[model samples]
Target: MEYADSKCNAYDTYASEAKLYPCLPPVVVPSAPELIRVEGSAQSYRLQKINEIQKEIATERDKHANLSKKYHRAVRIVAGVDNALVVSSMVLDATGIGVLSTIIAVAIATEGAAFG
Candidate 1:
């Protein structure tokens, strides 16, 4: 009982609690409130909003397709004009990176490539 503080401190703090009576957990009962949401076709409204978003996405897709077509056409024209450049820098010299770089550069330069 009268052990030195250093020797007693070496044992775990919970040893006292373990020797004593165990603590009991309190029971909890959750109350359910009257979940009445003032709904007059809320799902329809959400659907309408979703449809609008889808339409916007479709419009964006169309714009992207058109822009891609125009970009492809421009790249084709640029490549044709600079066929010698492409040839000298690419396949003829066994380097495809130059051709890919030209395509990317043309798209970036013309598109302004700045999202914004």
Candidate 2:
């Protein structure tokens, strides 16, 4: 009974010491070459992503430029049509006035000849 009691006391002391000072497992560190390889892969992935973004940016810029050119061309065509319509209206007005004036002159000459 005394021997069993001593063994129990020793276990209790060990448990108390373990609680006060905990022992953590050893940390496994990676080798230098393994760390370098991992870093290189990460850098390559980032560069690839950057290149893809740049390509997207260039594509968008091309689309924008094309749209701008089309818009300018449409504006120029509309302006030309408007100018042509204005000129045609002026020509029609002049022709109508010329016809009316000739008829009036003929009527006045006939009236003077009949009176004389």
Tens digit of per-residue lDDT, candidate 1, span 1-116: 33365332333456553333233457798899887875769978998999999999999999999999999999999989798786677665555677778999988887785652
CA lDDT of each prediction against the hidden true structure: 0.75, 0.81
**Clash statistics: count for each candidate:** 0, 0
Q: Quote each prediction's TM-score.
A: 0.44, 0.56
Candidate 1 Cα RMSD (Å)? 20.7
Q: What lDDT does model 1 reach?
A: 0.75
Task: Supply the global lDDT for candidate 2.
Answer: 0.81
Pick the lDDT winner.
2
Deviating ranges (above 4 Å) for candidate 2? 1-38
Runs with alpha carbons beyond 4 Å of true place in candidate 1: 1-10, 13-38, 84-116
